[model samples]
Target: MSRSKTDKPSALVATRPDPFRAAFQQTVELLIQRRADLLSETAINAYVDCDWLTWRGGSLKLTTTGENICAQLRNKARLHARA
Candidate 1:
């Protein structure tokens, strides 16, 4: 009689982080401390890597997508405040 054989998974997918998460969080923290109408490029750059951050004009402004990202951070802060 032949016996059925099953092989376990050989290799798992290797995944690495963006390597910018820490910088992103740092930028968010600084912004939270400022709690101002807008954050400056210098400040954001000081914390987060400029590679991902982008802006224009003397007054640095977040891009359309950045706004969404900031909004999410704000929401998280609000949720945390209640806790």
Candidate 2:
């Protein structure tokens, strides 16, 4: 059937934010702030899979790569806000 001009888009067809990116950012923030206890399973897995996080002794820690990524994320966020 032909659609009408005023018809609203279906909710199922709506674009959503990337879940992985959201989780990754949350993970990075928590790790950088030393709040690992607040991290979710998805966040931990995403960071570990990207090699941005690591286990040190009995605690979760950010690798050097993780630190660099966090810095980049911060810079990007700042730029986006300015825009």
Candidate 3:
């Protein structure tokens, strides 16, 4: 068997990370497990710590910081893939 320089070896390719997704999933699981109404005040407080946490909403209703944090985390993840 032979390989060419134009064909990248599988080992050389980096995988993308999805911590934000993991966090989001954990949060949702907590929401369900605790039976906390999504509208409950305590749930809101608990979820807000993620900084860029967002719920489904219109443009103005989205959590700006939460969205920003997720974007940055994803971008940083991409940077890591480049390394």
Best by TM-score: 2
Q: For residues 11-67, could you state the per-residue lDDT of candidate 3 as single tens digits?
A: 221222364344644455454575435445553543453333344542112256545
lDDT of 2 by residue, 1-83 (tens): 88664333222112323464445677766777888889887767656655667788977887776676667667878999999
Per-residue lDDT over 18-60 for candidate 1, one digit per residue giving the tens place of the 0 to 100 score: 3333345556555457542455555466322332344454433
The C-alpha lDDT values of all candidates are 0.45, 0.65, 0.46
The regions of model 2 sitting more than 4 angstroms off are 1-19, 32-34
- Cα error, residue 51 of model 1, in Å, equals 9.1
Model 3 stretches astray by more than 4 angstroms: 1-44, 49-51, 54-62
Measured on C-alpha atoms, candidate 3 has an lDDT of 0.46
> Superposing every Cα of model 3 onto the true structure, what RMSD results?
16.4
In TM-score terms, candidate 1 sits at 0.36
Q: In terms of TM-score, how similar is model 2 to the real structure?
A: 0.59
Estimate TM-scores for all models: 0.36, 0.59, 0.36
* Cα lDDT, model 3, residue 63: 57
Best by lDDT: 2
Cα deviation of 66 in candidate 3 (Å)?
Answer: 0.7
Count backbone overlaps in model 3. Answer: 3
